[model samples]
Target: MIIDTKKLQKEVLENKKNHGFNTTDIEFELLRLYGETNELFEAWRKQDKENIDEELADVGIFLLGISEMLGSGLGEDITNKMKVNRKRIYKNRDK
Candidate 1:
């Protein structure tokens, strides 16, 4: 099923509120996102499939929460970025 990222972002914000989590600290969220990314890398290095997917979800949750805090539509941003990426050429592709 196709996920509704905008709805997910709203749910993340609501969950943060319900849990008394940081809803206004972008820097803290960024740091936590970095930590989550590290965890994802470690999981990949260990070839732990379950943990890998979990860590990835953690990273995505942080990102969606951050996007909510910043009042950005993550879905739209990703779609636009993908369009830009599709039009770009990598000079190092032959290397």
Candidate 2:
């Protein structure tokens, strides 16, 4: 499915407004994003597929909302970054 990030961003912001979530504080958003990532990590560590998916979506949702709050296009930024990455060379890191 094709995802419309602009529309999703707007919807995310609207949901935040409806739920009375923090919309103006970038720091708070970043902290929330960090927490979501930690949750995602915990889900992965537990090998819980269901919770893993939910936490992954939560991370993406926070990212979309933060992009909207910053007046940035998350989709466009990703596309552009991908293009740059494609042209770059990288070495595999040891695990």
Candidate 3:
């Protein structure tokens, strides 16, 4: 099934609210992603690719959640930045 990231984020925040957690805030979500990325790095170092993938997904979910909460289109922003950087870094690498 295709997941609607915005709807899933809203649902997660609602569940957190029902449980007395303030997940509507972007900071909390960002901290969660930071922890998740650390875990993913650890798993990757241990050669646990499956767990790494799961943790990466968790990171992406939190990133999208925080971006939506903050009204930022981070996916597009990162893509545009990477495109410029790739051209500058890779296009002249042989020179």
Candidate 4:
């Protein structure tokens, strides 16, 4: 099934509220995102598909939460960034 990221983000925010998480602490979330990224790396290195998927989800959760805190539409931001990146030219290795 195709996941609805906006719905997921909304649920994440609601859960954070239910758990009494300090939603304003973007710094702490950034650190947590970093840890999740490292976990993803380790999972990839170990070839653990389950943990890899879990960590990847965690990374996305933290990122969406951060975007929520910043009042940004994560979906829109991603689309806009991708649009800009699509026009970029990479350096040739043989140059």
Scored by lDDT, the top model is 2
- Writing each residue's lDDT as its tens digit, candidate 3 over 13-48 gives 566668786556777777778899999999999999
Better of 3 and 4 by TM-score: 4
Query: What are the models' TM-scores?
Result: 0.95, 0.95, 0.66, 0.87
1-95: candidate 1 lDDT, tens digit per residue: 89899999999999999999999989999999999999999999999999999999999999999999999999999999999999998686865
Clash pairs of candidate 2? none
Give the local distance difference test score of model 1.
0.97
Which stretch of 10 consecutive residues in model 2 shows the poorest summed lDDT?
Answer: 86-95
Model 4 Cα lDDT, one tens digit per residue, 28-78: 999988999999999999999999999999999998888878777888888
The sequence of per-residue lDDT tens digits that candidate 2 reaches over residues 1-95 is: 99999999999999999999999999999999999999999999999999999999999999999999999999999999999999998789576
Q: Is candidate 1 or candidate 4 better by TM-score?
A: 1
What is the TM-score (0 to 1) of candidate 4? 0.87
- By TM-score, how accurate is candidate 2? 0.95
lDDT of 4 at 42: 98
Clashes of 2: 0
The per-model lDDT (C-alpha) reads: 0.97, 0.98, 0.75, 0.87
lDDT of 2: 0.98
lDDT of model 1, residue 64: 97
Where in model 3 is the C-alpha error above 4 Å? 1-22, 89-95
Quick one: ranking by lDDT, best first? 2, 1, 4, 3
Weakest ten-residue segment in model 3 by summed lDDT: 86-95
